[model samples]
Target chain A: MKTRYTYGGDEHIYVEIDDEMSLDAFFIALSLSNMVREANIPGVTEILPANASFEVRFDPDVIAPDAMMEKIKAFEHQAEAQEKRLDTRIIEIPVYYEDPWTHETLMRFRERHQDPTGSDLDYAARINGYETVADFIEAHHSQPWFVSMVGFVSGLPFLYQLVERDKQLEVPKYLRPRTDTPKLTVGYGGCFSCIYSVRGAGGYQMFGITPMPIYDPEQKISYLKDFMAFFKPGDIVKWKPIDRAEYDRITQAVEDGTYTPRIAEVAFDLDAFNDDMTGFNAKLMEALNDA
Target chain B: MTLEIIKPGLATTIQDLGRPGYFHLGIPEGGAMDRLAFRAANLLVGNDEGAAGLEAVFMGPEIKFGAEMSVAVTGAEMPMFLDGEPRETWTSFTVKPGQVLSFGFLKTGARIYIAISGGIDTPPALGSRSTYPIGALGGFEGRAIAAGDVIPVGDGSVVAEGRVVPDALRRRPGSPAELRVLTGLYWHRLTEKSQKAFFEDDWVVAPEADRMGYRFRGGQPMEFVDRPQPFGAGSDPSNIVDGCYSYGSIQVPGGLEPIVLHRDAVSGGGYFTLGAVISADMDLIGQLQPNTPVKFKRVEMDEALAARAERKTMISEIRQSLS
Candidate 1:
């Protein structure tokens, strides 16, 4: 269930397991690691697991790297002893793709997409069909997906990949061509799913709509319902769909406090600087000086 | 005490140290453009170095004090007066109740700082009193000071005795200043010719500069690896991963001109940075006005730290001498 490895004298540990465990477990583990205590050892900043490798960063002045490596190895051995110990839950989110602005935008997008060959298209195209796009979205409503980053922009939750697509969509560049890009824009660039935080000009292509606002200003919290987004580097993500009414109901529940939002955090090894890179300290110092 | 603004001048506002640790929430680290002058002006009075001080751009405000208060003015060499009497520059002075403090146009720097012993009284927003016009948050309802705005001053304590910084200690006004910088995120993506030009050529601070960022001319646009990452306003990886915002970030886009980020810039960006103006040189950058030619100087981290330490010591010594 658990494994540990050493990379360049530092501890890189990971846990091997089935995919059903909740992401909250990982969030808690990272938060605890940030407290910097391991078998009475102190000064650790983070223990981050990305791409199946967990890295621990600590103040080298207080603790030796090798000692931490030993602790990680011991911890992994203990984790290996436990199996099927954590409970996992699957959550489904319903998304509605009905908004006047979205409808108008979809029309324009379909027109642009059909540019090369002059083929008359209608909104009734099924799934990938220009026409059935909305219907396909509604049919897949209340589908459960994995959570990536919570409150990415105020309240927008970036979901993990929707693995069901037979073909992967082409992603755009990470950076939009310009600033002042408008809202309700959908762009695929990185490995994860991303939504705009607010209305501004953006390069993301227009996609379907979700009526619920990701961020709730008054509560100062985002309601990222059942989606766990807890996948480690190698974990699998399955995305399912739900209907329009279900989307409205879930959003209403979130807005009305019937649904609780979970907090998801990621930890990375800040101390593990890329020594090969020049001016590394300069960049760190820049942040420090400002601090 | 209070001061009735005769004219708000061009984009005047009260600023302090800034709102830190809120970048995660998409808040800009809004503060004074020239922190040195901001702190210096505060030190001239009895206020702590970070006390809220008036940031006056060229052509400062005309004001009448409602009560006798000790105030110190620094930054731009704008001819200042109280009751029409010529006042010394870079020093503290007493303005009698009902006396008017007016300033002529700045001849050198882009901004002038005016600090009151009591400091300006304004409600803090998002952990700071700095104004962010884009979000309409902080200082004076998140807006620039207007002609009719009455600024409140804190309760008085010690009187401010005028003390002039010696010619040897003061940075010579109008002297050409060099800005030291370090390479940033996308420094490698630039063309070899463009990169060489960046280090060798001189750039002029453009008129479009503000607290948010400074626009510079004369350097060819820096290139990035084929595509930029997610960038946006406010704190979100969507923006960062999306390549929307990059701090201390620079961007050339399609233009020959490059924009260097400053204090009030958004927390994230997606630009190819040739280099960022080092923290120590921020004050110098703040002092530059439109048309001011500046040469970029590269420095080691040690040199930057040393310069920063020296600046801190010099300011402290000056404060001690005055006290």
Candidate 2:
């Protein structure tokens, strides 16, 4: 994998580890970006790692761009020699599939969608070769997903499914972006899934909504007391499809400040994961359920 | 002290140097659009350069002061009125206990920064007083200042009158503003003709300009080189795999209007960015009025760094002169 280092103006250095999306690409970016961060390099203000690329915002006044680029290059070399094990967290996200909130939002923005005749879930299911929406929902939560990137808005996680490439669910975004996307709306675009953390403009194909607070500035929820944004890069998420009753119960728990997201910590090795995807995912789920 | 809002002008919000170090969380380093103007206004009023101030766009809000304090207006060349009496902008003057301050229609620029003797005392979210309305994160109640809102202010002890920012030092948009851009990031995606036309064409600022970004139109439609879309890259030729977006990054959606992502920009998106406006030129973009003619000047890395240095020197000059 050739990492292309591109300069963004004077302060930002964008390093694209790969052109396309894959676990391999994300691992390289995450590992190298981590190395760069741990180096405690002066002038490196922000290190933002994405799905396949990473951005380093630096103060050129303190560290010259060419010199900073050299440091990053050296860090990349060190990252190659280092072990690719990431101590990450696996969290259970309860998704209310085909929820009424997203249903109403998708209908309202139907004219901006590729298929105005049916719901976003229907179009995505039909296009992905699923006979029924039930089968599509099963395929969605059948395996875990990686929080490859966290952005677009505060605390929003762009999730990439951990299933084999052939089984990956791919869907196109809306033809035109909707002016409003319900907060915590489960959305799909391209090959990634995302939960809208805030109610704002979005073009992703709506599938469902989550009752749990995706972002709370007040840190109202117990699990999120330490940080306002719950999901971070390197997080593993297992989507659990729930009914309306379970959604209401969880929503109430959230209001009472007693809700804690189901999470388990684990050390992930990309090489080990590549060898036996299903077997490793089962073990990860076991740990999560046990927790 | 408090400033009681009477007539909240267009999109007025509290802003400071902004909360940095939060871009990774998808939260932008949002602050005043015109940072130099905001800083100078604060300095003129004996406040810290990064103090929280009101960023009024296009128009100005009518505010009644609870106590006597010094005030200064900077950025756009708009006529200021203190209780229906004309007052000089860019000059620090004291307001009486109940004197109302207002502004007339803008003459040249889009935004005006108002700095009081003491900074706005709005509670910060994530270490910034800057308003990010999309996230409802900061500023007065996480939104724009409205009528009947009595926003608190820090205590002002020193009242220095006759402090003025000279016209030569103030930032003013030239006739047909020229913005220096270091074009690189996905410039190769566009056809050779499109690349050449991007610099040659004269563009106009679209009405869609805001704190998030400035959209420019009137340029010829861009054409992309023929290439099969990559995996996870949306169907559009303008689409790339979702990636990080930096401040001042310019992304042309649908090969139509070019939007320059600003301080409050979404950190990552799927669209391809042509390049970024140099950091030095970013402050000037915030002052551009809609329909204002503009030219994009292509610059290299060496020149971009030189401009950055030059701007730093200019700021230092402003600081020294004010002190």
Candidate 3:
């Protein structure tokens, strides 16, 4: 695959792996960015991996831009040639669907929504050919999703389903952005899904609320103590539907600092998955369930 | 030493060069908007270029000195006063114990920077005193200063007083400022007519502008080349597959308003960015007030690099002249 590299002013170099978002493009970006980080280049200030592209911010004073670009190209070559496996963790996120908080918040901003009469979940389900919201939620949780990027806000993961393009759920963003979205609100837009890490302006269609926090600045949660953000690019996430009672219990545990996210170490083989998704996913889920 | 905020002006906060190297974690490089003015104030106070200082917006703070200190005011041209008596700007001055420092109406520019001999003594978070208010991270308990709040001052050694930055070095924020930009990334996504309009139109900064981004109006609604929207790309014509955003990149969402992403902006989004404001012109953007008219001028890579080098040389000259 060809990659396009462009200069973002004198300080940043943006590398676009592909024009479209695909698991293959994301893998290339993830591998390339990881290699750049491991190289520990002195002048490189930041390595931001996105859906199908990555950006590197460097100080030209410390290392010439040309030299830095050359180094990145070299890293890209090495990354592409390396093994197709990636060392990452699969996390299970418990969510309360059609929660009251997001329900109220979404209703208040109905004018901004495409279908103001119905809830976000109802609109999403109907457009995607599902007869009921429950069936839509079941389809969403049946398969795992890959964390293609972690951005837009701190710890907010943009997840793309592991299924083929035909099976992927697609929805349009709000006609206009809402002034406020409740924190941890599980939102779906375009063909990707995300959990709002903070309460701020958002245009995604809110469907539910996650009980656990993906971002903890104080690092109160043991799993997030090392870093304020929980999700990283390439991490797999499995959403689990939960009742209000379980949601309240998990919320209380989170507040008491005893909630540890269900995470299992796994080596993802991109080639194997691309070749045979069902066989690959069965193995991937087994790794998580067995662990 | 400490300084008590007798009257907290509009959005006063502690800032420095900002936290870098953490954009991967989705943290913005929050810092003083006007880098040139920030460094000027620090240099005037004999502190390092990255020393923490106070950034006041629109109105300046009324601070009462708890101890004797040397200070300098830079950026926006605001009327300065010491205990109800007039004071000077762009030059260093001494403040006696119990003296109250204040300012009058803003004459020009948007932000005013206050630098003391000893910098603001807020403990650094994530390697800088710069405040990221969205995450409530870094600088003076991670929030804007309020009245009755007392902030600590570092034991910074003072240089001779009355050191002034030459008038030529000072940036004059004017109406319809021409900002140089290097068009790239998704620049080709826009149609020829829209691209021409972007450069030809005189854009007015909206009043809702803040540290995150500056929205502009008056340009013909930008039009994109027709194409099938890719998966995960939104329905908007300006939307693309999610991509990384440079600090100064310009994005036209919904093709209506063009927003210039700033130091405190999100790291990446699905919006299609036309280009970025060159590093040298970022300081100029920092001084842009609401309703300010601006124009974008396209430049080559060589010109951008040369301008960046010129800024570096200018900073070094200012430091040498002060020392």
Candidate 4:
């Protein structure tokens, strides 16, 4: 795929690896971003890695835009030639599907949704060929998702399904963005799903709410003591659908600083995955189970 | 030392040179909008150029100094009052204990930077003392300073009053500010007519102006080049697959008004950005008043870089003059 490099003023350079978002496209973009970070190119102040794209904010005074572009091209080539295995973590996040909080939120913003007559879950379920919301929920948590990008807001992780492209769930964002989304709400838009790290403006359709806090600036939660943001790029997430009782229990545990997300170390090999998607996925699951 | 907030003006927040290197985490480099004014205030008060200071919008806050300390105010032409007596802005003055420094209605510009001899000693969040309320991090209690809030101040024992920023050094937007724009990013998405109209038209700053972005209206509704929507991009003609948003990136959602993302905006979104205001000209956006007319002047990369250098040189000149 041809890459597009465009300037964002004098300070930033946006690099689009592909117009379409896919795991394969994202892997290459991540690889290049990783290489650029490792190089520690002077004047490169901030390197943001998005799905199928990346941006670098730099000091033009120190490193000219042309020079930065040349180095990025070299790094991209080098990264493409390197092995495609990435050391990552698989974390289990407990989600309460069709939770009351998000339901109320989505209901409040129905005027902005594609189907004002139905709930976000119902609309998403109908569009994706699910007989009922329950079936759609099953399809959502049936497989793990890859954390392709973490942004738009503090600690928000955009998840792309681990399954093949044909099996991916596609949903359009709201006709207009909602001014308020419940924090930790599980939101789906386009081919990706996201957990709202903070309560703020969002366009994604609300599906559920997770008790697990992805971001804690206060570090009140013990597990998040290391960093404010929990999810990182390249991390894999396994969703565990829980009832209200379990959600409450986890929420209590989270407040008590006793709850810790179940995380497992895993190494992803793109070559193996491309060769046999089913076989590699089973192995990846095995790795998570082993941990 | 300590300072008590007697009155929290409209959208008063603590800011510095901003925290960088965390855009990947979606935290913006949120600091002073007018970097030169911020630096001038700090330099006037013998504090570090990047020291945390109060950035007040149209209205200014009433801060009561606990003890005699040197302070300076810069940016925005406003009437300053020291315990009901008129005081000059852009010139450092000594405020005694129980003497509350305040301001009247702003005549021109939008934001003003108030630098205390000792900078506001707010705890740094992700390496910045800038108050970014959305993330609920930084500044006093990770939010805007409220009235009666007691804020900690660093050692400002080194005090030399009456250091003034010359009138010419004060940067204020003209009646119709000519903001330079570097057309790139998703500029190709806009029709040629729309592109030309964007440059030729005069836009007014909407009331939606804030630290997040400056929304411009009054321009002809932009028309996008029609094409089948991309796989993941939203249905809107102005929508693209969510991409990283740069500081000063101008996005026109649904081919309507352009909103230039500022220092405190989200790092990425799905809106189609036509281009970005050159970094050198971004500071001007902060001082823009509501209903102020502005024209987007297109500039090439070389010209943008030259403008950046010129801004840097001017800052250096200020530093040298102050020193």
Candidate 5:
């Protein structure tokens, strides 16, 4: 892949890994960003990984813009040459589909949706050729998703399905954004799925709600003791469909400070996954299920 | 020392140099919009350049001093009063306990800065006292100031009085301000005509402008080169696969109005960015009021860095003069 590096003023360098979105492109972005982070270049302040590109914010005084550009080019070349094996965690996120909270919120803002009369899930399912909402949910959870980016809001992960583009779900954003989306609302837009980390304005088609919080500003959760955000750029998330009773139980655990997200350590071989997705996914699922 | 808010004007909040290094988490680097003015106000009162100060927009707040202390009002040319007696701006003056500070009218600029001898001592969130209100993070109670709220002051005060910022150093906000920009990222996506119009057209700052971004109008609707919308990218021609947005980057949402991302903008999004305002000109954008006409001038990287260095030198000179 040819990396196109552009200057974002003198302070930032935006590197486009590819023109289109692909798991391979995201993997390259993830790998390059991690390498950049490990380099600890003096002026580099922040490393932001996105869907098909990454950006580095730096102080021009400490490191010249040209010097930083050269450093990035070198890192990109090195990252491409190396064997792409990433040490990542597969997290099980319990989601209650057709939950009452998001369902009520979605109904209230029906005018903002693409299909005003039907529910967000129904609209998404019909367009994707799924027979029912339940079938759509099954298809959504059939494969694990790679967190391509963590942005838009704190801890909000933009998840791309691990499957091929043909199998990936796509939905249009709302005609107008809704002013009120409940926190932890699972939303779908374009070819990405996300959980609203905070309760605020959102434009994505709402489908379900996750009982567990992805963001805790107070750092109350043990896992978030060091950082308030839960998801990283390359983290994999598997959404497990749960019932109302399980949702309530998890919600209770979270409030009681006993909820620790189910996470499994897994070595993701990008090359192997690209070759045989079924075998790779089966092994990945076993690793997660064993945990 | 302490100050009580007698009348909380239009969107008054505590701000400093802002919190950086957390953009990956989607946290905005919220801070004083007019950083040059913010630093000037602090220097006048003999405080650190990064000291927290009160930022007032459009209207100024009426604050009552709880103790005798020195204060300087900077940025917008608002007619300030100390206990009903008119006071000059851009200079430090002492205020007695029970003396109420107020403003008459906004003469120029959009935002004003109020720096006391001791800085506003709000607890830092993510290493800065600046406020990010949308996320309800930082500043006093995670929002703008309100009447009857008392703000705590730090004891980082130095005995300084009558410090005045030179008129040359002070920025005079005007219409059709030319802002220098480095055009890149997705600059090639726009048509030749649209790209030319982006620079040639005089864009006015819309009323919807705020800390997150400044939306501009009056430019010809931008047209992009025809291409199949990439997967994961939105259907709009202007939309690209969600990418990292640099602070000061300009994005045209529907290829209509352009929004210049600012200090409190979301770190990354799907919008197609064409250019970014150079670091030195960010303060100029900060001073822009509603209806302020702006023209973006594309500059090279060398010119942008030279401007940044010049601004740094100017700040140092201001600090030296005040000290």
Candidate 6:
């Protein structure tokens, strides 16, 4: 039996299991334990893969470092005694990488790679695995995607692990910087995937655009509104792409207020005013006028 | 007791200690830029530290008191008069009913703190009395102080005389000062020369500086990270994650001159923050005037924490003296 090692730091803690198979189990067990108050989890803070290890963070005041490490060690011991199949789900996100911007990016990436035998293109194909970008778009019409971090710009989520190709993608710096990237714009930083929220200047290679309004302040019940953020660390993500027409339907659903993306059950209260307010309204109006 | 605004200052808003937590919802914790001065003013007038006080910028408004009350003024050296008589600040004084208390232009800081015997009576939003100018939430009707606006105080009653003012606060400091900083989440990404220039160069606050942020000139241009980057969460690989950051988180998009984020800043961004001005020095930032010269002095985490702890102890003692 191999032992797991977990170390705690000021902001986050490091968790290491004996093997890859134990990753999900370790996360679930730690989450189930009553060792920490879940609310203190830092914004967009979670356990994520770091090469071969996993790192996670929480408020040090809430969950003492030493105790969290012990919990991980205990979970490893339990797993060794009674091994079980890891409960992992596969979610598919339909990707259409056929836009002119995408093609230009791929070409740029190939040039940067400079593979003599066209192996870079082949490597890209292998990671994508579909015959063509159009086929990849067509294969997953009804597949679902997992959520990562929300609250970017305004409720933007950084989702991923789409293909996890062995070939590490190299992303170059922005040639020139502009000031804004609107919401639902798809961008690629080498192999890592990113989705932008609102228009803001960025440096990553942008691939496509989605006009869907993922964040709406008017909806009282939803924090991220049309874009439901439910995936935590260690969740499985299998992407199945849809054709342009189906993509339009999903976006329209978001626009028309009929769409509900997959989400986890988390307590969300909008009326949690913890302090006193005396003259906020008039002050806000005055500020706007002055600005 | 209430005060009717005769002339609204350049900008004025009611602010409390601030709204903590709820950053996951993408709300920046907005409050008084100079929290120490704000709290001190509140305590001098028999008000709680969390009471709503007016943050007056550049100049203060001419206010007509409806009834007799106790008031305290703090933050910078701004001229004041009570019914045409010169009013000394840093002292808790009485105001007669129907008397007009007016403030002259600031000779030092950009904002001044005003506290009444009782707290202001604005509605709380997301656990705060401070105003977020962008979202139009908190403070007086979720807006700034304007002409003809009337702000209500709690109880409309008078309490016993409060403690004597602290010496450190009695003399308002001058503008063009050196600001302390802690290396930010992406300080290492900046080149060595840039880092040196950032700390050594004297930067001037631009007139464009506002509650949302302070724009500075004269510092060497910031260079973007050589690698591709994402927005917000992708940018802050630290615990902050996604959402607006604390005031003083200096962001330089694509290596531009650093813009110090301030109260009422937007909820989220993709820019790189080389450093954040600690809470202790933010009030100093608020006091800075346009074209004022300033320098950044780097401090370690231990030193910053120690300074904060000392401030906490001092504030509590000051509170004790009043009670």
RMSD of each: 11.7, 1.9, 2.1, 1.9, 2.6, 12.6
Q: Is candidate 2 or candidate 6 better by DockQ?
A: 2
Q: Per-residue alpha-carbon lDDT of model 3 for A1-291, expressed as tens digits? A: 678888887788899988777887887888898898899999988889988999999988798878888888887777677676778888889989999999999989998787889999999999999999999999888889998888877778899998988898988777656768999999987788998888876778898999999887767787788988888887988898999999999999988888878888887888888899988777777777765
Which prediction has the highest lDDT against the true structure? 2
Q: After superposition, which runs of candidate 2 have C-alpha atoms over 4 Å from their true positions? A: A108-111
Minimal lDDT window, size 10, model 3 chain B:
B230-239
Q: Candidate 3 residues B1-323, lDDT tens each?
A: 99999998999889999988777767888899999899999999889888999999899999999888889999989999999988788899888899999999999898999999889998898899988877778877778898999999999765677899988788765668888899988998999999999999989988868888888888898888998887678677777777889999998877778888888888877778888998888888778888899999999878888989898888887888788
Compared with the true structure, all predictions reach lDDT values of 0.52, 0.88, 0.86, 0.88, 0.87, 0.55
For each candidate, the DockQ is 0.07, 0.65, 0.65, 0.68, 0.59, 0.08
Candidate 1 lDDT, tens digit per residue, A154-205? 3233443322333223232322233342343333333334445555423333
lDDT of model 6 at position B38: 86
> What CAPRI-style quality would you assign to candidate 5?
medium
**lDDT of candidate 4?**
0.88
lDDT of 2 at B62: 96
- Candidate 3 at A133: error in angstroms? 2.7
- Say what the RMSD of model 3 is: 2.1
**TM-scores, one per candidate:** 0.63, 0.95, 0.95, 0.96, 0.92, 0.62
Candidate 2 overall lDDT versus native: 0.88
Q: Return the DockQ of model 3.
A: 0.65
The segments of candidate 4 whose C-alpha lies over 4 angstroms from its true place after superposition are: A286-291
Model 2 docking tier (incorrect/acceptable/medium/high): medium
Q: After superposition, how far is residue A106 of candidate 3 from its true place, in Å?
A: 3.1
Q: Per-residue error at A19 for model 4, in Å?
A: 0.8
**Tens-digit lDDT string for candidate 4 (B33-80):** 999889999999999999999999999999999977889999988999
TM-score of chain B of each: 0.90, 0.98, 0.98, 0.99, 0.98, 0.89
For residues A68-186, could you state the per-residue lDDT of candidate 4 as single tens digits? 88888877666566676789988888999989999999889998777899999999899889999999999999888888888888889998888887787878788766779999999
